[model samples]
Target chain A: MEKVLQINNLSKNYGNIRAIEDVSFEVKKGEVYGLLGPNGSGKTTTLAVIMGILNANGGSYEWFEQPFSKLSRRRIGALIETPNFYPYLTLWENLKIVAKIKDADEKDINNALGIANLLKRKHTNFGHLSLGMKQRMSLASVLIGNPEVLVLDEPTNGLDPEGFAEVRNIILSQADAGKTIIIASHILDEVEKVCSHVAILKSGDLIANGRVGELLSAEETVYIQTQKPEDLIKSLKESDLAKEVYSSDDDVAVVLNTDLNSGDLNKFCFEKGFTLTKIQVRKQSLEDQFLQLVK
Target chain B: MKKLFNLEKIKALSYPPFKTLMIIHFLLFFLVILVVSRIHFSIPGFSVKGLYQFPNIWEFFPWVASWFNIFLTIVLITLVGNEFSFKTFRQNVIDGLDRNDLIKGKLILIFTIAVYTFIMVLIAVLIFGLIFGISLLF
Candidate 1:
């Protein structure tokens, strides 16, 4: 796969404090890559550095396998942190400004607005719109040039549930069209549904990165209650059935190996003469996985 | 260059404050000159009309306009300050403009405004000079 972006050990600092340090990731063509992290975890800082809004303190990044340049910048449309448009300009006029910057045709303005569902409010000033509408307008601006890649930071910041679903649909449709996307968001469900791959960040470090299913959903943890919890845990650890065995309150928490399911572990426990009083299978939600990783 | 100019044009022209300040600047310049022209000196050695006549009007109009240059400065500052306050400068880069392109766009705006004021003062001088000079001939 062709690489759309490559960041190697990128670092950034704000005066005495380090915002992001030694962070790195790659986004390939047509891949919906998500930068997932909690608030103040350097998601916005990473995007800003790549977008040239802030200079990196150390290391570097490249677009399309070359050094970042104006031409490459035109190929990517980005919305970072907030919707920063001329508050006084009408939605149409503000998008027109973006169109001009990207050397896109004026006709694109309408198409972009239509896609964002802001066509009816085109003549309204940006400052006058509701916060959700402003976010949609930012999405509209990102679509102005019909760029090959889109970089969005908290794209659904102020949206209602319907608007949130609308933004997700737009992102999915864009991904379906084979446009590479890099989204920085703390919304785990959003990233889980929209991103093909993810890089999890914690306090400016790339803690984990890979396919969503493999990184977050591959493991299923089963909690079992037996007469002798410590003995069951010891037996499970001794056997090849469990990858990890620990106690969660009164129950024994077991993460079964890839080849073994909860059923296999149950059968093995029965064979070992352990009477299971309670057997519960739980799939870790993305939120749970995200919290665990960040924690 | 043309693209940046177009962008700046859309931003500035649509802004109400930009338009309002510009109009005020224009009116204040003309008002000062018009009011000063009306003052009649009792001293025999001096007359305000002399300042409005042919050769004098060229220098006099621009010098009078210079005092109001402060207003133009305010206008320029407002435009640039809005970019920072709104954080649109950062957005502009993310939208595809280079950092130098931003400075260039402001420079273009400044040049355009300079040209506008130059023409405005020139026309004002020409009209006032011909009106006063022709009257003196009679």
Candidate 2:
């Protein structure tokens, strides 16, 4: 697969504060890559640096296998941090500005607005729109040039449930069209649903990176309820069926090995004279994985 | 270059403050020149009419226009300040403009404003100077 973006040991600092340190990752073509982290975890900083808005303190990044340049920027549509349109300009006018910069035809303005569902409000001033509408307008602007790569930071910020779903659909549709996307978001569900690969950042360091399912679902946790929880945990610990067994509030949480499943564990416990009252299998959610990684 | 200019044009022309400040700058320049032309000095040595004729009008019109350059400066400052306050400079780069292109776009805007003021003063100088000079013939 062709490499869309490659960052090698990228570092950035603000005065005395180090924003991101020795962080590195690569995004391949047609992959929806996610950058996930907590607040101030350098998600936005990383995006800003790669987008050429902020200079890195050390290291470098490349786009399309070449040094980042103006032409490379033209091939990527990006919206970082917030929707930064001219508040006074109408939605159509603001998108027109973006279209002009990308050397795109004026017809693209209407196409983008229609996609963002802001065509009815195209002539309305950006400042006058609701916060959710402003965000949608930002999405509209990002679609102006129909670039192959889209870099979006907190793309669903300030959106209602319906609007959030709408933006998610737009992103998924774009991905379906085979456009590679790089999104930096704190919303783990969004990343989980939208990204094929993810890089988890914690306090300016690249802690984890790989396929979302492999990285986040390496172990399946089974919540088992039994009359004798202590004996069940002890028996499971003695057996190789459970990787880690610990007590929850009233249930016992067991992380099973990769090759083991909940049925196998239940069978093992049944043979050991332990009757399971309730057994619920769950894959570790991205949120749970993210919290554990950042913690 | 044309792309940046078109981008800046859409940004500035649609802005109500930009248009309002530019109109005020234009009207104030002509207003000052017209108002100053009507001043009747009691002192015989200094006739206000002399200021509107030929070479004098050339100097007089530009000098009067210079006073309103502060308005132009404010307009320029407002436009540039907007990029920061709105963080649109960062967005513009993300949208495909180079960082240098931001400065270049503003430079083009500055040059365009300079040309507009020049023409306003030039036409004022020509019309006033020719009118006053022709009146002197009568």
Candidate 3:
């Protein structure tokens, strides 16, 4: 697949504060790439630099393997923070201005409104809409002109469960239509659900980067208790199936490497003439894995 | 630039307070011209009447009109500030309006307002002088 975006050793500083340092990641075409980190971990700053809202202090980036330009930006839809609109203007009027700016067909306004279910409230003033509605309206702008890629920062911020579900569905539908997405999010569950790949950031540093499944599936904490504790420890140490083995109270804890089945480990220990008394496979949630990575 | 200016004009219409400010700015422009042109005073045998005359009209009109340019400045600032205060300026950039396009839009608005006010002053002074000037009738 062609590279949709590539960032190399990108860094930014705000006064004396390091906002992002040595951040590097590549987003391929048609993938939902997530920039996942806690608040103040440089997620927003990274996104701002990627969307060209802020100049990087060092390094470079490319979109579609080409230099950034208005033409390149035209093919991308983005929402950085809060929804921006004239408060006194009705929702439809706000969208009309957005459509005009985007050079999009007027008809897409209705399509976007329909998708966001804001058609009924189209005539309502933007100031009067609920926070969720305001978020949905901003999200609707992304669908205008059907841009090929979307760069969204905290796209699901301030949304209710229903609003959250709607936004996720819209993103999935966009991806289904072969549109690529780059999303910056502090919400682990949201990213885990939507992103095909993820880059984890901590304190302005890119700490982890890989496919979500690979990264999430990498940490498996397996617990096993054998009749012979010494044999269990020695066998686990000698066998490369699990690298991280320790004694936690009465049970021995071992972390299984990729594709190394707990069943296979149990069988190997049994074949070594040590019958397992208890075995437990614990899969760490994305949040747990993220916490571990951040740590 | 014209397209962007036109779009900005249309967008501004959606905000009623903006329209109100613009109306006040326009009405005040006319009112200032009218009041400045028709001033008449007499102090103990010294009389000054009809500031709207051929040469005086041309000379004094621009100066008077220039004062009212503040109205346009205020209106323009409010209009531009609305975009910044509401973060619509950033949104416009994100919506694929090259940042230069936004700057150009505001410039066109400023230009349009300046030229429009200038021409209004010219037209207003011409009518005032044509109706009451001493040059043609004297």
Candidate 4:
């Protein structure tokens, strides 16, 4: 797939504090890329730099191979932080202003509002809407031009479960429609669900980056049950290769510390006179991977 | 420019605060005229050095309207302040509206307000001009 957005070692600083340092990543066309990190970990800053909202101290970015020019930005949409609208204005009026600013068609205003699930509330005053509705209206403003790429920071933050679910559905559907999406969110489960690729940032540096499944699944843990659980624990302890070894009821949870084969662990346990009754290998989740990288 | 103008008008009309302000300002403009006309009745026209010193009720209208213009300017600046102090402008940037678009949108709003205010005041001036002239005849 062609690269839609590329950041080449972008950096930003606020006085002596570096918000982002040497951050580099590529968001491929039609892919949902997640920038997974904790709060104040440069997610918003990086987005600001990429979107040309804040001037970068170093490095460069390109949108659709056009070197972050004004023309290139026209095809991009972003919501880096909390967006606000006139509370006293109707939803339709707010978006009409946005569409006009972007030089987009006024006729497409209703379509954008509908996609945000706010068509019925188009005539309602913005101040009277719920938080989730306000968020959706903000999103509708960005979606007015039907841009090819979207950069969003915490798209589902401050939302209820239902609102989060709605945002997730909208993101997934947009990805399916061949739009490239870049989301920076603390909701790891949401990222795992919707993102094809991910970059983990910690304290202004990118420590881990790759496909969402591979970066996470590389560190699977195995659960073993045996009558000779004691002997199995002793063997694992002697090897010093198990990241975590604990017993829960009749089973033992053995996390692999190195890139060792699961079959080998089973074989090693069997050779040590332990009968492996059951073995369950679970894939490592995004949250676990994120913690490991940041830690 | 036309697109931006239409959008600015829609936003101003849709928002209750600005709409309310429009009405209040219109009334205030007429109120100034009424109060000045009332005071002009008791003033005596006097002649000094072969020159007529007429009680000019309309002389104060321009000063009142100019003060109103200053108030309008403050209100306009408040609109921009609302976006920044509330962080909505930053949010608009995130929502994919480009920087140029935002600047253009603001310019359009200011231009629209200037034009609307100028036209409204001009019409008021024309109406008052006829009224004051007819009163002199009677």
lDDT of 4 by residue, A142-219 (tens): 787889988888888899999999888888888899999999988898899999999999999988888987887767
Query: Alpha carbon lDDT of residue B95, candidate 3?
Result: 84
Residues A52-143, candidate 2, lDDT per residue (tens digit)? 88999999999999999888988899989989989898888888888888889889999999988989999899999988888888888988
- Supply the DockQ value of model 1: 0.84
Provide the overall lDDT of each model, using Cα atoms, as 2-decimal numbers: 0.90, 0.89, 0.84, 0.78
* Highest-scoring model, TM-score: 1
Judged by DockQ cut-offs, the docking class of candidate 2 is high
Q: Quality of candidate 1's docking, in CAPRI categories? A: high
RMSD (Å) per prediction: 2.3, 2.6, 3.8, 4.3
lDDT per residue (tens digit) for residues B1-138 in model 1:
787778888888887888988898899999999998888764687578999997888899999999888878998999999999999998888888878989999999999999999999999999889988998899
How high is the lDDT of residue A128 in model 2? 99
| lDDT of predicted model 2 | 0.89
True contacts kept of each: 1.00, 0.98, 0.74, 0.50
- TM per candidate comes to 0.93, 0.91, 0.86, 0.83
* Candidate closer to the true structure by lDDT (higher is better), 1 or 2: 1
**Backbone clashes in each candidate structure, one number apiece?**
0, 0, 0, 7
Model 4 DockQ reads: 0.43
Candidate 1: the clashing residue pairs are: none
Error of 3 at A172 (Å): 1.3
